[model samples]
Target: MSAYSQQPALLDPLPLSPPKKEDELPVALQDIVTAAITEEVLGTVLERHVQAHKPKEPRVVALTADSISIYYLQPVREYWYLPLKQTHTIRIAPLLPVLPVDASETETAKWVAEIKDRITRFTETKDAPVDRFIPPNHWGDWSGVAVFMGFTLLIAAYLLGVGVVEQFVFTTERRFNIAVAVHCGVLIKRSKDVNEMKDLLDKHWSGDSKGRYLWVITSWIEGWRAVSRLRREIARLNLLIAAAEEETAKGTKKESKKKR
Candidate 1:
């Protein structure tokens, strides 16, 4: 017998069958597989598809008492449900043109009142979409940091020179105390300005006082020089008012002299 014939018939390898056609798959399975393949080929295909099909108008849904549900249209059609009791904060952009160049005090007051009323309504409403416009945080700007540091160093140098001058009129301890006192006075004045801003926000933005307070603090950090300039203008206005009163009294005296 041949060597091949000596091998056992049971040891013969079986032939493999051909792969199944995609069309041969069950309808449901075919759809699933097709979707997976499409997703693999086009990254974020589902998100694009949803966006293409989604309605132009936004949808508002009223949630049940213990849970809040959010549906996102982008990155995919997804649903998120969170406990209603969870603390959540709403961020808003600082309203620009806060006071118009030509705006009167009454107009500014009315605008603030309207904003407060809107915020109050937003807090009370359920499942309302809040449009947020976030302003860029300028504290992280390197240019701003450099300018602030330069100004602070200049102020320190000037104060140090003043302290040295005081040494001629005061003891060493007294000179040091005076310098410290002057620096502290400047800071105290700035703090008072910040407090005034906070009070104004509290009066007009009662709904989100914390947010308003934070905005004021950030504004001071970014624009303390501007705040100081505004304070100076107010002082000048007071001086003008006093001068006007003096002029009116002198005119009255001149009229009395003419009558005599």
Candidate 2:
């Protein structure tokens, strides 16, 4: 009779019922990876809620006195900064999952793989923005102009000398030719051409007498080639100059509009 009647008056109440699973827990964050942790670490635990993800290198860290803590972070232009004052304790429960087996042995390996994948996103297929054309001025200094002019005049003079020589050879009479031959013999007494000329001619003659004219004609042709090449360069320069002028005019128009 006493045993049933006096259970210490069932004092301390019937001992409170155990709390619900969630209620009994302290402030707990199960799979939290700090900002200093790699995304791979976070992926192991938390289910990421992202519509659009920012591309960035992973690096997260946790500051702890004894337990974990979380703080709100403000977004800067390219990064986020954690608030100094406000923070709450977070209870860490378990290590996150192995994110799909990093296959990569080292962090560097993972980073390299990530970088390669990211680079693929920016291949030639992407329609990236391009800058407007800016023509370069390369006409060079007065000294460069002077150097070019000097060479041009020298070539012209050589050409003129050659043409003059050829004309003299064609127009001179028999007496002038004979006189030239004799003068050439005296100047080129040792030349084989002189000996050959003496044999070819009915009378004494020297082929070496024609050497000057031959040299001049060949030089004239070379000079003409140089002039032709210079013409092409001039045409290219003209096109470039015209483009630069057009750009300059457009820039002026824009400035005028701004002023108005």
Q: Top model by lDDT, which number?
A: 1
Q: Model 1, 1-260: lDDT tens per residue?
A: 22222333332111212223331333542343333322222222211111122222111111111111112232223334222221111121111123354767688566445444332322222221111112333455445546555555645655677664445544566665775676567567667667755553443332344555454654454345433323322222322333344466669999999999
lDDT of each: 0.36, 0.31
Pick out the ten consecutive residues of candidate 2 with the lowest summed lDDT. Answer: 125-134
Which whole-number lDDT from 0 to 100 does residue 234 have in model 2?
Answer: 25
Candidate 1 deviant stretches above 4 angstroms:
1-179, 206-210, 219-260
Instruction: Provide the lowest-lDDT 10-residue window in model 1.
Output: 59-68
Segments of candidate 2 deviating more than 4 angstroms: 1-221
Backbone clashes in each candidate structure, one number apiece? 0, 6
Per-prediction TM-score to the true structure, in the order listed: 0.21, 0.18
